[model samples]
Target: MPVPGFADRWRIEPVGAMRVPGVVFASAALLPQVAEEEALRQVANVATLPGIVEASFAMPDVHWGYGFPIGGVAATDVEDGGIVSPGGVGFDISCGVRLLAAPVTLGEVGAALRRLMDRLGVTIPRGLGSGGVWHLPDAGALRKVLEGGARAAAQAGLGTEADLRRCEDGGVLVGADAAQVGERALARGLHQVGSLGSGNHFLEVQVVEKVDDPTTAAAFGLSASQVCVMIHCGSRGLGHQICSDHVRLMRDAMARYAITVPDAQLACVPVRSPEGRSYLAAMAAAANYGRANRQALTVTTRAAFAEALGTSAGSLQLVYDVSHNLAKLEHHDIGGSERLLCVHRKGATRALPPGHPDLPDDLRPFGQPVLVPGSMGTASYVLTGVVPGEAFASACHGAGRTMSRHAALRHVRGAELCRRLEASGIAVRASSLRGLAEEAPEAYKDIYEVVATCERAGLARRVARLRPIGVVKG
Candidate 1:
C-alpha cells in the first residue's frame, strides 16, 4: 500500500489482517526522524488489533516503545468484541502532567529564586527507592489514596476542593477498585505516593515567556512573566507492577479465547472478559494513586514557596491536570452513532474541544488545557483543543526521545550539561549526575517542531510558552 501525505498527516492503507488504516500526524521535516525508529511499523501493527475503529494514529512525537508507539492513539469498539491492551496504556498508568500557576511573577520571585528551588529540592522526595511527602500508616490508609486519588488527599488536608475541580476526572478516575490491586503492588505504592521517579520525571519551576492566545491563556490563569510549576510523574512502582501482572495475565488468557495478535507485547482480552475488567479496575486504582501523588507534591511545593517567599499555598492555583496514559471508556460518535469505545492514549495528551461537557464550567468556552512539557532546559507549551479534532482529540505529550540514555551518556557529561544549564540562568537539582546526563536536551527531538506539527495538524492550538528557570530531577 502506498503512503500519501495530506496536510500535516500521512496515511498508510491497511493490508493483511489490519482492521483499519493508519494515520501519522507529522510534518515533512519530522518524517525523517520519525522514520528512523520502529514506531511506524508499530503503528501498522496496532491497526491489526480486533474491533479497532477509524484508524490507528500516531502523533508528531511518535517513537519506538514496548508495543504501541509512545505517541500512539487507538480506540476499540467496546460492544464489538473490543480488546484492551496494557501496552496501549504503557506501565505508567496515568502518567501525566500537571501545571500550577502561582500568583507571583518572575520579577517578584527573582531575588528568592535560588532559595525557593533549594527548598523544593530538599522537600520533594525523588529517585528510585521509596519515600514521599505523605506516608500511609497502613494498607487502610493506602486504600484511600488508591480509591480517592487527589480528592482523598484533599480531604486529608493535602489540598483543596478547588484543586480537585481543576483536575481531570476531578482527580479520581471513577470505577477504581482497590481490591483489584495486588498485595505486591500495594506494598510498592504505600511509601511511594508523591515521589518523582527516575528517568524523565521532574518538577520544574518555570516562567511564562509568552502568550500566543491571550484570551485562552487568561482563562487558564496564565499570563506573561507569571510563575508556574510543572510536574511530570506517574503512579510509580504500583502502576508498573499492575501492568506487569495484567500483561502476563492477558498473555496467558488470550489462547483460551482463541485470539491472536501480531505481537506478544500487545497482549489483550475482550473488554468485557474477567481478566480485562480486572485490569481496568486495577489500572484505575493506580491512576488515582498517580493523581494523589502529584497532589502531595503540590502541598510540599506550596509549603516550600511559603517558607521561601512568604506566599500562601492558595497563591498556586491549578491550571489543569490531565493524564496522557491509560485506556478510557468514553462515548464518541462513530459512523454517525454514539458508541462506547476503549480509547488508549500512551504518551499522548487528551485534547477535548470547547463545549465538551467533560470540561469544567469556567473552562468550557476555552477547551481543555493540554500541557506539553519539553526536554529539560527547553521551553514548554500550553495548548488547547480545537473543534473538528483528529485522533480522538489527542496531541503529543513531550519532545519524543531521539536518543537512548546510553547514547546520551556517551555524547555528553552530566557535569557539563549542568554547567551549561546553570550558565543559562536555569537552576539544576538532580539526585545524581548520571541521571542528568541521560536526559540531556540533545537526547530528544525539537519541542518547538513537535508542537508546531500538532498545531498544523489541528490536533491542538498553542496558548502559552513556558521557560524553565529551575528544575528538580529524579
Candidate 2:
C-alpha cells in the first residue's frame, strides 16, 4: 500500500518470516507494472534475510531477477550476524556505467557524427566472445588487473590520474584477493579485460539536450548541447563465474551455518563465516576487473574520438564512473548509533549526497553524479544524490527492462529497428540485429517516468537529460 504522505512510496508490511517491511519506490503509473511481476514477492523475500536493517527496498525501476529483485537494496548489520548473499549482488558484479564528457558540442560535431560513430563502431570491442582492447599475456597479468582495477590500467599508461580520481573507490576495489579467484574465472577474464559483453551492454554517444539544474549540471562538467560518451557493461564472464562459484559454495555451506532463506536462490552465510569472507574477497576482485574493463573502454573511446574528430585523447574528461551491482561494508546511523553494515545493491547505483567525504574534492559540493542509461536510442539522465537519501543512499541504475529479450525479439526486427533509428538521426552499429532488437526502446519502462519518480521519492535529483546520437551495441 502507498505510504500515507509519500505518493511515490509503497510499504509491504511484514506478513511472514520477514524481519523488516518492504518499501518500494515507484509512481502510480509504474506501480501497476511493477506489482504485476514477481519482483514484489522477491522484495518480501529479501526482507526476511537475516540481520537486514531498515526495510528491504526496491527502486522505482524494479524488475524480476534471480533472487533479490534487480533494483533491490538491502543493508544488514555486521555485528548482529549479518549475512551476504551472491544473489543479492547478482552475477554481473560491479556491472556499472561511466560517463565521459567531450570537449566538442553537438554543433561542432555536425556532419562528422557518422564518421565518429563509424570510428567507434570498429574500434570499440564488444559482443560476447569478442577479445578486449587489452589482453593479458598470462594469469599473472590478469591477477594484476583483478587486484589493481583501473589503477592497474592507469599504471600501464592506458589511463591517467584524473581518470582514477573520477572513478568510484579511486578505480581499485580494496580487499580484493586475486588468490581467491578460480582458474576458470581467470581464464575467462584473461582475453576480455576491456570489452563490452552482450545483452544490453553499449557504448553511446550523446548530447546534453536539457539541463534541469544548470548549476548542478555545470558542477558535473555538463552543459546543454555538449557531447558525451556513456559506456555500460560489467565484469563479463569473470564476474559471472565468481558469482556462480560463490553461490554454489554458499548454498552448500548454508546448512552448516544454520542459515535458512525463503528461496534457495537467496542462499547466504554469516558475514564473518569463512564462506562469506571468501565470496566477498572474490567479489571484490571481480569488481576491480569490472572497473578495469570500463577504464580500458574509456581509453579506446578517447582514441576513437581523436582519430575521427582530429582532437586529442585529452579532449575527453571523465565525469564519473559508478557501479550498480555488488555489496560493500559501510557505516550508517541506526537508532542513534553508527553501525557497520553490508549494503547490497543489485541493479542499483550508489548515490552519495552532497558534502559526502567519499566524493572527489572538486565534486563534493555538487554531490555524486548518478548515470542512468536509457534503452537504445533514447534519452538518458544524469542525477545527483540528495541528503536524506532513501534506500541506503541508492537509486535506479537504468530504465529497467519491461519485456524479456525473447519477447522483445518477437516484437521488433533488428534490421527494421536499425533503419528506424537511422531515420531518426541516430547512428546505430550492432554486432547482431537480433541482439539489437532485444534492446528496443519500447522494451523498457519510460526513462523519464523512472527518474521523475526517483526525484519525488527523494532518492536523487535530476541534473541533466541526454539524448543519444549514436550507439555501439554488444
Candidate 3:
C-alpha cells in the first residue's frame, strides 16, 4: 500500500513486521519542528518491536526521547511474544494531571490571590531535592502504598474513598510488587509524596471561563464562572529510579537475548521474561506512589482552599484525575479480534470513550475527563474522550513544549515574565527565579492550537476553558 499520508508534515511507511502502517500526526507548520528526524525515526523503530499489533503512532507534539518519542503510543500482544520497553513509559511514571472544582468562585479569591499564592509557595516544596511535610515512610508501609495506591493513602488519612472514585484506575494498578523496587528508589520516594517536583510540574488556581459542553460540564460538576485547581506532577525520584534501574537491566537482558535495535535506549525484554515482569511490577509500584502523591496533594489543596475561603473540605470536590505516563494492560480490537495488549503511553492521556467499564459511573455519561494544562500564563482546557477510529483511545497530554528549558532561559527573564503575568491578573510564585525562566509561556506550543488539532483529529472534544488566577510552581 502507498504510505499513509497525514498532511505534508507526516510521512508514514510500513517497516519490518508491523501489522499496521505507522501514523504521524502533525501539520505543515509543525513539519519543520519535526525536521530533527529523531521522533519520526523512533516511530519506525517502534514498528520493529516484536508483537507490535498496530501502527506505532506519534502525536503532533512528538519529540526525540530516551526510547520512544515523548508523544509516542504503542500496543503489543503479550501472547504473541510482545515486549515492554521502559523507555516507552518514560522516567516520570504516572506523571499525571488533576483538576478540582471549588465551591468558591474567582471573585471570592481574586483579592487574596497573592496571599494564597504565597501560602502555597511556602507550603509546597519545589526545586531540586526539596522536601515536603510528609515524613519518609518505612519500606513496609511504602510497599503497601505501591500495592494499594490511593486507597493506601486514604487509609493513612491523606484522602477519602470518594477521591479514588474520581481517579483513573481508582488510583491503583494491580500487580505492583514493592519487592521488585530497589532500596534507593524507595528512599528517594519516601519523602517526596505530596511534594511538587520541578520541570513542567505546577499547581494553579483557575476560573472556569467557558463551558463548551453543558451536559458533560454538569456531569463533571463544573459550571461557567466556577473556580478550580489544577495539579500537574509525577512519581518524582522514585519513578525516575525505577526507569533508570530497568533501563540498565533491559540493556543487559538484550545482550542475553541477542536482540538488536536501531537504538540502545529501546532495550527491552519479552513481557513474559523475568526481567520484564520485575520491571513492570516495580513500575506499577512507582506509579502507585505517584497516585498517592497526587492524592496527598489534593488533601493539602483542600486544606488551603478551606483555610483561605473559610470553607470546609466537604464542600471541595475533586473533578477528575488522569495520568499521562505509564503502560497499561488493556483490551482493544485489532483486525476485528479482541486481544489483551500492553499499551504504553508517554506524554499521552488515556481518553476512554463513554460507557467504558473503567470510567467512574458518574462520569460514564460524560466520557473520561481529559485535563490539558497549558503553561502558567496560558489557558487550560477540559475535554472528553470521543469514540471514532481511536487507535487506543488516547489524547494529547498538555501544551507540549516547543523550546528547551535552556533555550527558554536564554530568551526570557524571570522578573519580566512575572510582571507580565501579574499585569494580566495572574499571581505567580516559584521556588526559584531561574526555574521560572525555564517555563516561560513562549517555551510551549499554543495550547489552543493543540486542543483544536485534537478535536479535528477526532481524539477528544473540548468541554470547557479555564483561565488561571494564581499559579504555584516548584
Candidate 4:
C-alpha cells in the first residue's frame, strides 16, 4: 500500500531488484489521486533500470505514461554503465514550450481578439498530417533544419540571434548528426515545421494575469495584462519514427548486450555503446527538428500577430524556448563528487538554477524560465528555476492528465466546451472537435494546486501567471 498523503515527497525503498529508491513529489491533497493511478508503480519500475544513480523521481503532476511516469526524471552515470532509453525520452522527442511576449497590452488587442484567432487558425496548419508551414526548399534544407534547429531558422531570417541566445542550447544541438536520421523519418518530418501536432498540443494567445516575483517578471519582459503567445509542439512524425526505430533496435539487441528489464518499453543500450551513440546522435537530430519546428511556428505567429495588430514583428520578443523530453549528458554533483551522467527527463523540464553556466548572460542573475502549461482554457504559470536541490534540476512539465482522453469525451462535448470558453472571454479554434473535447480542462489536475505544490517542494518558484485569451488546438 502507498503511504498516506504526500510529505514534500514520499520515498520508496528498493525492493525486488531495484537499483535505487523511487521518490514522488506531491502534496497531501494530490497523494490520493497519485496513489490511485498506475504512475506510482511505473515510478518504482524505473528504479530497476541499469546504472541508475539518484532516486527515480516524479514531479507533482505525475501520471501513468509509457514505461515512465509523465513527470519522471532520472540520471545514470555514463562512466558507470549508464544507458539511454527511447522510452525514457518519449516518442515526441524534445516536445517543449516556447513563450513570446507581445509589446501590446491585452486592452489594446481586446476588440481584435476574435479576428486574431481567426487569422491564426487559418494561417497555422494543425492537427494530424499538418505540414508545409516551414517552406523547406530542398532536401539539403531539411538536413540543415534537422542539424542546426532554430539557429538555422534564424540564419534563414525566421528569428534573430537574441532569440537564439534566449533558447536552451541556443535553440540548436550543435552535435546533431543528420546522417543518423532515417530516411523514413526524414520523409515524415521534411515539411512539418511550424505545425502544431495533435493531442494536447496547442498555440495560445495569452495575457499575463499576475506576477509573483515582479523583479523576475520584468527581466522576462513581462507585465500584468501583457499579451503573449505560447506554443507547445515537438519534432512531430520524425521524432516519433526515430524513437520507434531505435526502440526496436535496442529491444531486439538487449539479449546480445545481456540486458533485460521488467518492461520491454524500457528498452535501452549503454550510453557509450555503438547503438547508444547512434541513438544519441539520432535523438539530438530529432530534438533539433523539434527546436526548428517551434522556431518556425514562432515566425508564423509573429507574422500573424503583426498583421492582425498592426505591430512590428520585433514587438513580439521571445521569452524562452525549452525542451522537455530529452536525455542529455550533464554534470551533476553526486555525494561530494561531480560526475558526468546521462539525465533522462521524459515529461519534465530543466530548471537550471541561477549562476548556471548554460544560462544566457542577461538571465544569469535570475534563473532559467520554466513554462508550465495548464489544461485547455486554464491558467499557466511561468516559474524561475531554483537550485534544483534534490530533483536533478527538473520540474513538472504541465498539469498532468487525471483522466484519459476517452474519459474526457464522456464528461464534456467539444462544441459546448468551446461555447463556455467563449462566454468566459476566451476564443477557441480547433481543427477537430473530438480533439478539443479530449483536451478539456477538467480532464487534468488543477494547475494552480499543482504549481503550488511544486513551489512548496522547492523545485521552482512562481514568477508569473498567464491566462489564455485565445487558443488554437491541433
Q: What TM-score would each prediction reach against the true structure?
A: 0.98, 0.99, 0.95, 0.98
Report the lDDT tens digits of candidate 4 across residue range 1-474. Answer: 343553467888899988999988888888888989899889988898888997999999999998888899989899998889999999999999999999889998979888789889998889877674888877788999988999999998888998898899998876689898889998898888879888999999999999999999999889999999999999999999999999999999788778888888899988989899999999999999899889888888888888888866336899999999999999999988999989999989999998899999899889999999999899999998997555789998999999989999999999999999999999999998889999999999989889998898888999999999999998
Tens-digit lDDT string for candidate 2 (145-187)? 9999999999988899999999999999899999999999998
Root mean square deviation (Cα) for candidate 4: 1.6
Residue range 407-444, candidate 1, lDDT tens digits: 99999999999999999999999998999999999999
Q: Rate residue 95 of model 1 by lDDT.
A: 96
Sort by TM-score, top down from the best? 2, 1, 4, 3
Which segments of model 4 are wrong by more than 4 Å?
1-7
Worst 10 residues of 2 by lDDT: 306-315
Candidate 2: clashing pairs of residues: none
RMSD of 2: 0.9
The 0-to-1 C-alpha lDDT of every candidate, in the order given, reads 0.93, 0.93, 0.83, 0.89
Q: Model 1 off-target regions past 4 Å? A: 1-5
lDDT of 2 at 185: 96
The stretch of ten residues in a row with the least summed lDDT in candidate 4 is: 1-10
**C-alpha RMSD of each candidate structure in angstroms:** 1.2, 0.9, 2.1, 1.6
Off by over 4 Å in 2: none
TM-score of candidate 1 relative to the true fold: 0.98
lDDT of 3 by residue, 305-368 (tens): 7666666522668889898998888899887999888898998899999888888889986799
Best by TM-score: 2
